[model samples]
Target: MRGFSLLDSSGLPVAKTCFDPANIPEALHLDVWRQASRCGAQVDSLQRDWRFRGRTSNWYTDGVVFSHTLCDATHYQRTPRHIRRGDSDCLVLKLQLAGHQQGIFGDFDHFSSPPGTLVLQDWAIPYNITTTPYEVMAVSIPRYLLRGSHLMYRRNPVITWQPDSPQARLLVPILTQTLKSLATASAGEADAYAAGITGLLDGLLLGDRELLQSKYRERDRLEDMRQYLSRHLSDPDLGADHLCRQFHCSRATVYRLFQREGGIATFILRQRLQRCMQEISRMGVVQKGFLEALAHTWGFSSRANLARHFKAYYGITPQQAVEAARSHQNEGQREMNAPYWRDAHRVSRWLESIAPGASPTEPAGAHGGTRQGPRELAGH
Candidate 1:
C-alpha cells in the first residue's frame, strides 16, 4: 500500500498527508512515504521552477534503525532553506551509484564521488554535498548494531568517495545487485535481505581505517559500552549505573549518549528483549506457548507487557519472530553442504577474470566453508 505521513519514534501519525501525487507538488517528499514506496525519493519541479529530481529510496527495517537506499539521477539544488535541516540529519550513507559529485569537507580537503564509490556522513555534522544526476545506492544503519571499537564517521565526518579501494569496489556491485533482488522479494524475505545488506555496509565502513581513527571515536565507544552491557544482561542489577561503573564513564557521559532513548532503564530493557528474541529464534520450530516461558527466562515479569512491546518494535509478535527465525535457520541448514559451498569457487573465477589484480584476501572457497547469511552473525 502506498501512503505518506511523518511519524515520530512512537509510530504515531502527526503531519500533513498526501497519498496521491497529484495533490502534493512533485517537489515535496516525506521520508515515511518515500520508504514505503521502496523507490528513490525526490521533491521536484517547484512553482519557482526549481527542480529536485531523485527516485524513491528503497528501505526495510525491524525497528531500532536499519535502512538501505538507492537514489537514481538525484539532483537537488535551489532547495528551500527550511528543508536544509531535514536533508542533513536523516543520518543516511550516500554511496555514489554513478556520475560525479564534488564538494568541500573542510578548508584544505575537497571531495568527489564518482560511480562505483562510497561515502559516509552523520546528520549531526554540517557539510555540503552535490551530485550530478547519477545513480547511487546506500544503507542507513543505526549506529548501535555496528561491531568494533572505532568511531568511523564522527570525526572525519565524511568519506568523499574512492573508486579504487578493493572494499569499495566489492561493495558497489554487491549493493547494486542486492537492491535489484530486493525489489521482487516477499514480505518474509525483506527483513533478512535488509539485514544482509546492513551487515555488508557495516563491514565496509568499520573496515576502513580513516573512518575508524578520527571522527567516529565516540560512536565506537558507545557501541562497545552497549555490547559490554549485553554480555551482562543475566545479572539482576544490570542497568545504567552498573554500566557507568563498568565503563568508568561519568553519569553525564552515559546520559548524553542515551538521551534520545528516554533513559538507561529503557535502553537496558530493549537490549534484553533483543537478546531474548535472538535466543528464541535459535530454538528453531516452536509453538507460541514457548514464548511465555521464554519471556520469563529473559526476565520479563509479565508476558502481556513483553508481547506488546516486542510486537511494537519488531512488527511481529514474539511468536512470529520465532517462526521467522526458524524458517531462516532451516533454510540455511540445507545450504551448508559441500556442494553448495562450491558456489564460491565459481564466483572467485568470475572475479579473477574481471579484475585480475583484485584479490585482497583468500576467497571463501579456499577456506572451504559455506556462505552464511546475516541472521547468524554473532552479537558483539
Candidate 2:
C-alpha cells in the first residue's frame, strides 16, 4: 500500500494510491492482495499456463473512484455474506481496453465482455467472474451519486455496451481520454471529469428504448413483489417460501429477482426493521413493555433483536430513535440513507490511512475528502 498526496493550484487536497507490486513474488499475489484491496472480493491466481501479475491504481475523490488496472487470468467472487455486510458500496463500470472476461451476474446474461465494451457490476448482487490478461479503466460511483439517474441496473437488459454501439463509440473515447489525462488533472478538473463521465453514462444507458422497456418489464414484477412484502411484513411466515407460493415463482427466481436489494432475506429484514423504526419514532416515552411488544408486532423476536439491527442500520438504537424523533433530529439519518455506501469506509481507510476519528462504518465520501491524480498501476 503506497500513497502520496499533493495540493493542486486550487488548494484542494489531492491523494492517489497504487499497489504497483501488490504482491512481492507473483506466486504470493492472492495471499497478499487483500491487504491492499478493501473491496472484499476473493481473487484467486490461476495455476500453470502463465505467471500471475497485476497492478491497481486508484484516484480518490468526488464521491467516486477511478481505477486503472492491468492483470492476467484471475477468478473473482463476492458471496452473499459479502453483500450482507455491504462491503461494496459502489456500482462499478469497467471499460475494457483489451482482452475479455466472463462471469455470472444476477442482473444480466452470463456473457463474456469484449474489448471496448463497458460492463456494469452492481455490488449489491453476488458475482463469479474470470478475466484474461487485460488493460482496463474502471470507476466506482456511490449509490447516492446516481439516485437521480433513474438507473434500475438490476432490470436493465443492456448490461454490456459493445464497442460498435453509438453510445459506446461516443463514451469509450471520452473515458479513455479522461483516464489518460488524470495523470495530471487538477482537483477542479477531476471534479468536472467525474460529473461529465457519470452524466454520459446515465444518459447513454437510458437512451435505448428497447433496453428501457426491458427494464420496466422486469421492474413490474419486482414492484409487485415489493407490494406483497409490504402488506405481509407482520406475518410470521412471510418470506421466500411465501413469495414462491403466492407468485408461482421458484426459490431461485425469488432470490435472483431480489438480488438488487442484496438478496431476498436481506430485503425482508431491512424492510421490517424500517417499519419497526417508524412505529418506534412515534411512540414517545414508551415503556420497556410497550417497546418489547412493538418489536414483536414488527416481526422481531424481541426488543433486543430489534435493537441490534437498528443500531447497525441506523447507527442508533430504538430508544435513541425515539428521542431523536421527539427532538426532530433528522439530519444524521438522512446522511446515512445511502445503505450501499454506508459500509464503504474500507476504501477510504485503505487510500489515506483513515480520516481522523472517522467511524469504521462511515463512507469514504461522507468524511473530509481528498483528490488525487492517477498513478502507475498494474492490477489486483
TM-score of 1: 0.38
How much lDDT does each candidate structure score? 0.44, 0.58
Q: In candidate 2, residue 321 scores what lDDT?
A: 52
Assess candidate 2 and give its TM-score to the true structure.
Answer: 0.53
TM-score of each: 0.38, 0.53
Lowest-lDDT window of 10 residues in candidate 2?
351-360
- Assess the local accuracy of residue 38 in candidate 1 as a C-alpha lDDT between 0 and 100: 20
Those runs of model 2 whose alpha carbons end farther than 4 Å from true positions after fitting are: 1-13, 48-55, 148-150, 215-380
lDDT of 1 at 227: 67
lDDT of 2 by residue, 24-117 (tens): 3343333334333545465543322223245556665555677787765555666666655554455677898887776655422244687878
lDDT of 2 at 139: 79
150-170, model 1: which lDDT tens digit per residue?
Answer: 243334545555668776677
lDDT of 2 at 127: 63
CA RMSD (A), model 2? 15.9
Per-residue lDDT for 354 in model 2?
A: 19
Residue 250, model 1, lDDT: 87
